[model samples]
Every structure is written in structure tokens, then in C-alpha cells.
Target: MNQNGSEQKHYIDQYLREDRMPHIWCPGCGLGSILHCFLSSLIKSGIDMDKVVVVSGIGCTGRAAGYVKLDSFHTTHGRAIPFATGLKIANPELQVVVFSGDGDLIAIGGNHLIHAARRNIDMTVICVNNFNYGMTGGQLGPTTPLGARTQTSPIGNYERPFSLPYLAAASGAVYVARWTSMHVRRLEQTITEALLKRGFRFIEVIAPCPTTYGRRNRQPTGLDQMRYYRENSIIRHGADPKDVDIDLNGKIIVGKFIDIERPTYSDLLDEVMQRAFGTELPKDDTSKEEATVVGSAPK
Candidate 1:
């Protein structure tokens, strides 16, 4: 409603928790744009909103779960993947989407991320790579580029950053893609596609942390970062993920790298249960007496 007593509506209102108006992302931060693209993608997917769930770990991007209108969980730092995996296993019908930052997803939670992809969990991961740990005073993170400056590396970082798309592809993610917040339309489309797919899907989104990362990297504003992405990004669909590494002020190869079919964890679990019991386990067997108990393998 407007101040004039007239009704007002925005297309994205339905997907957001209106009560939580005015997000906490700083001025010139790209997290807002990332969230917008994600919600827009949800609308484009034409999926049942009730069946969708959002999970996020502790970081600037983790607030996305609290802002979204869908069922969501703001899990502990670096634990979003394992928590989301539990949700999927408990109810296979739910479409779980993990929205978190590079620091949370790749630093502390890195092991879980790789193993989840290795197991081929049926979930989508939207990793916002802001180069540093934006939520915690812009410290050095696992994905901070070499020679980049952060609070922990005021002179310059000496560590090599992980190429997220390459890592996800190598870890057995069935669908892998990379894009920046500047590529809104393409990003929304890719998210829509990832949402409908069944397997471990990973999308690495390069976003600006203007208040922290940008302040030190010469891209002091989100607009500056967007301009950089506009000028430096190159779209090469089907390119090898291994060749898509990003460097400071270097050409960023952005596109869909891998889209392959693989048996998901749920699929393999069903197969094993069928082989052991001569039938698949009931998905909704809530009662103890009705639930099947495994004793010994059939001879």
C-alpha cells in the first residue's frame, strides 16, 4: 500500500518477505542484485513455491534465506550444504537451493561442498564469490585472488584462489556455470535451468563487495565492479571448466561449462534399498510399525 491509500505491488514482492523490507546489504554491494536475480529466476522457473526451500550459511549472502518468502534455514557458518543435504534426504520432493558466499561455502565448508557434489546430491548451490569474507570485516578468504588486498593482506595476498567452476566440475557437479551480477538476464536464465535439473548443480556468481573488497581493489563502488565485468567478461559456452580461472583484472570466462547427466544420491539410495529389500522404502512411512527395518541381506 502506498501513502495515498492506494494499492501498490512489485513483481518481486511475492517472492520476498515484505516484513523484512530494506535489506542490510551496503550501498554499492552486489548482494542485492544477486538476490534479485535469484528471486526472478524462481519466478521464471514456474515451480511450486511450497516445494522450494532456501538454505544459507553465515555470511553477508546468507541473509538471503531470511529475506526470501519460501521455507528457509540460516544454518551455522559453513554448514549450509550438510543441512540442506539432510533436508533433501528427509523429503525428496523438496527443491533445496543453497545461497551462500564463497568464504562460507569454500573456506570453512569446503570439504562438505566437494563431498556433496561427489555424492551427486539433488540440490542447487548458488555461490556468491565476493573475493573476500565480506561479512567479517573483509578478511582473506579461500577465493580471494592472488595479489588482491584485503584486511588480512594489506600489502597483497600471496595465496592462489580456487577456480570455483573448475572445482565444482571436478568434484562431479552435473551442472556448472559462472556469471557475474552484471549478467542479470543470463544469470536468471541459468538459475531457472539449474532449478529444474536433478543432480548437484553449482553456479558461481562474481559479485561486488564494495564496502570491503572493492574499497581495497580500486573498484570502490559496485558500479565500478559492474563496469569491470562488462569490459572484461567473455562468454564462451561449452568451454572447459579448467580453463576458466579468474585473476585480478584479467579476462573472466563466463558461461555454462558442464551440463551432464549423473545418478543422484537419492537415485542410488533407492537402487540399494530395492536390491536389499526387493522393494523401495516408502517415502512417507512416519509410523514406527509401518517403517521397514533392515535385518540381514536376503541370501
Candidate 2:
């Protein structure tokens, strides 16, 4: 509320709930840091808060929708995309963003994820990948590295994890980038790009769940996790996704892997409608007498 009969624009503080100040996340959880970076990016982008809609799925990272004061929708587990899709189609002018956890996006909603990318829908998808399903007590997820230990895999995971960024790029996402919480500046830039891009844009932020995955994997604290990112992560533009791999107890690659322009689903839909209605039908110029003489008498 303001004197000019318009809602005053305060910083993100106005959007946050002070009562929810002490968030429910565990100590050293990277979700808070990622949320901070995202809000910072939104402020830097200068988009009108009212025009931005944040949609989220059910997970620790999905709590982002609750914290942000912007118009938000908290959908069922692994269904953020379809919900956001409807919002975007209904109000194409609004900026739609989807915040999801690694497991939510890659495990249960994996088919929808790829199809959205393939359709080139106009939305930004920010996937916080902490390697395991932190909200469910550290179960193995699609992004968990091979041989990593989780509550469900105390004997070390044997299945290969999905390379999220590469999968998005290969699935036709116009903008695909991978950044860890350590690279806040680059992460912000990538997110800004994704928001501004007109097609499906995917960003994978490698966050740390110190309470579950980190501590169990011997990286006890957030600082230890940051050190791991600093020591093992690579920083370079256009790094090949094939070369980027996280070996068990080995180096982890992080960087902006892909950025390309592509026609969005909305753009293609408009084209289709224009083609269907733009042309006129052939006209009938013959008179009634000519038709009767040609033996095509009227009923």
C-alpha cells in the first residue's frame, strides 16, 4: 500500500514471511542459498513481481513457492510442468517459472520433463539437484551418482544417474546450464538467460543437502561441501557434456553447457492458427439458371 493508490514495491523482504523466517530446512542445507540466489536473480532481472508466477512440486526445494510472495501454485509431486503449462497457455504474457527437486523432475515426472523440452514450451525450469531425495530421508534419485550411499542404498548405489543438463539439451531445451551453489554469479546469469529465453530453458543447480547426503557421504558441513565444489568443479563456457562426469570420490564438472535459439511452442501454435485461417475459400460464381441447365437442380 502506498499514498498514490498503488501497491508499493519493496524489495524481496516484502515478499518473504518473517514468521517463516527460521525455515524448516536442516542446518547447512543448500536450498536456502539457492533460494537466495534465485530471488537475487529475479530482483536483478527487474521483472514486475506481479507478473511473475512461481510454480513448484512437492519436495524440499519445492518450498520455494511458499517463501516467494509472487503468485505461486503448489502442485502435486512431480507435476509442476503440466500445471505451469496451463498457466502459461492461459496467460501468455505472464512469466512462468517451475522450481523442482531432482527427484521430482527426473524420477517421477521424467516423461513430462522430456516432452516439455521437446515441445519447446515457454517456461523456466530450475531443478535443484542435491544428488539424493533429501525430503524423503535420503533415498537414491535419478541424479545421484553411481556408487553413492543413500538411506535406501547403504551398500552404495549401483545404477547410473541421469546427466540432467545433457538430458535437457538432448531433449530440445533451448537453454541448458549446470551450476553448483558455489557459482552464485554464474548461476544468476544463467537463470536470467533462461527467464528471458522464449523457449524451454532448463537450469540444474547442484545444491548440497548436508543433513542427509553430505553427512552420510563424509562431507559433514556446508563448508566441506563448498570446498568440494571449489576443488572439483570446472568453470568454463561451452564445456562438452560428454566430458563432464562425476566419478565416485572424484572430480565434478560444472559449467554452462548449452545455449541455442529455438521456436517455442507458442510461436509454433500461432503459426498453425494463422495458416489455418489466413486463406479464403474458393467462391462459387455460377448463377442458379446455369446450375439448373447443368442438371444440378435445386432441391
lDDT values for all models: 0.92, 0.83
Off by over 4 Å in 1: 1-7, 280-299
Candidate 2 lDDT over residue span 1-299, tens digit each? 53335565446666665445557888877788778778888888888888999999999988888888789988998999999998887567889999989888899889889999999999999999999989889898887888888998998999988888788988998888888888888888888777777889899998888888988898989789988988888776788776776666688777778888888888887677667755342112222345566775544
Using alpha carbons, what is the TM-score of model 2? 0.88
Best-matching candidate per TM-score: 1
Please write out the lDDT profile of model 1 over residues 1-299, one tens digit for every residue.
73335488677878888777678899888888889998888888998999999999998999999999999999999999999999999789999999999999999999999999999999999999999999889999889889999999999999999999999999999999999999999999999999999999999999988899998999999899999999999999999998998898899999999999999999998887767766444535532334344323343
Candidate 2 residues lying further than 4 Å off, grouped into runs, are 1-11, 279-299
For model 2, the run of ten residues with the poorest summed lDDT: 279-288
TM-score for candidate 1, please give it.
0.93
Alpha carbon deviation, residue 285, candidate 1 (Å): 4.8
